[model samples]
Target: MMIVALMASVSACASTYRVPREEAPPEWREDGKPTGFMPIEGSAKSFPGNHKERGVIMEFAVENERTAIITNTLEWTGPFGGSNIIPAGSPAYARQFSLRMSSNYGSYFGKDMNAYNNPIEWCVPRFDKGDAVCIFWEGSDRARYIDTSGGTPLNASPTSPSGMVGPMPQVQEQAVDFGHQMKIQVIVDTFRSNRITVATRISEGDDWSSLGRTKVMFDEGDTVTLKRFDGEFKLTAHRAGNGEITDVDVEVIKEPKAGRLQTFKDVLEMFMALKAAEAAKAAEDTDESDTASSPEED
Candidate 1:
């Protein structure tokens, strides 16, 4: 029945919109898809040459109307409430593919994905009556969907039309436990490159122990001068390291001119930055209050 709904909802070919590297990402970018897993489709276009994850192999096992199983770790059921056509020529995993991509994944990673892959993958999937399909790759972030119902009973992972709606889940960060204090190193190779590396060391007694490091190559430029890592995330200042994070520690000598080696001086830098931001916000509030009470300009 749900498959029938999909067949009924067809649209013109999608138009492609490539993200310019020089441009800035939109604010309030969505983090992870609010809907946990992305619904899998029958078959995906193979740009295996792109050399990212080909997507883990999964299945669709119908259990109840509300549940389905793919593996011991993966399961699904019921139907995604929304069912609408995704715009055509949507970039697969590119920074601009989804507004939230930048918030957690960073603009650099998105650009790296778009560089070699199709600028946009056709998002519209047509289904015939009784056409059951294989699951979409759960690991793929390119699965930005607003509606999954084509009047069918297919399981869907739906997203808000305006991206994330409602409050975003707060990052529950547990402070990175590394003895006393810790130091973070950010290395940037800025010469028409799209890779960002995160490395950290923790003070142990008197020596600095390497925690772990991770380097993500993006689809574009690095807009982050100094950012707290949060999906692929929350390497925030000196707060906490996400359990899901498995970055290795990196050790690199400083390079002059090209990029600056940003070091977080414990947590003082973060505290001061927060204070500055608060002061700025307070100033703006004062200005707004003054303007509101003043007479309107002609």
Candidate 2:
């Protein structure tokens, strides 16, 4: 009887934690889609040409098998400049920076999906007035949202007279498979006087379960990796510097080999190539116009 009981226990353990057989989903989405949150493109372009962006890019490949790479690029889409403008002691201000995570198959800034496009995952600081950052997941059937602070469904109602702006969707609880392997990247946005703690969980209908590892703290320019696998959980912490990403702690799992971090010189070279191409195109157009307008030599 004891032998039988031991065997049963082992089977249960194996069932609970096993490396995924087929490739896992590109990312772990708590629900189906996000409502209140703006699209990734919208947020990045909020300031027009004045926007400054800094975050890591993750990529997956199928060479020998499935392998992934992470590149941390702290770059501005255009010129880089700024400090938090919210007034001190203002109603719009918060004691801690709000951090939220998002993952997608395409460039977070891209308008279309492509495999060569790196999967963009990063934690962003929400500064929009009256905005609350929340956690979300996408199951096979539908997407769901939850208030990170209150653990409530993120449902919204109409507020404007013109009816142009719709009400925020009310949160509806649902079951989520917490056992699935997940890859999450956390980024630090605003550097305030205080550190911020982030907590996560998985839910099923009205029931919710805590991830074995919960709670992480972050300050500005910090990046951390959160991934779960067969009985093994991995976290990699790092601090971003100019053209450099330094690992903050000892990494446990082996990371896929990576190329050197991009530098300002690389950016300059890109700009130069673009200018040269443009110049060549313009010269060709001018020559064609001259031929069309010139009188016949005879």
- Best by TM-score, which number? 2
lDDT of 1 by residue, 18-102 (tens): 2233322221122331211121132211111111121111112111111112211212222333333222221111111222223
lDDT for 155 (candidate 1): 22
lDDT of 2 by residue, 1-298 (tens): 0000001112211111111223224342212222111112111111111111222222111110111111222211111223222121221100111111223542243332112222111121222321322212222322212112221121111111010111122222232221212222222222222222222222223332222222333323453333321111233344355523333332334333212111123323534554565567668968988999999988
Worst-scoring 10-residue span by lDDT in model 1: 1-10
lDDT value for model 2: 0.24
What overall lDDT goes with each candidate model?
Answer: 0.25, 0.24
For candidate 1, report its TM-score: 0.15
Q: Cα deviation of 62 in candidate 2 (Å)?
A: 17
- True-vs-predicted CA distance for residue 52, candidate 1, Å: 34
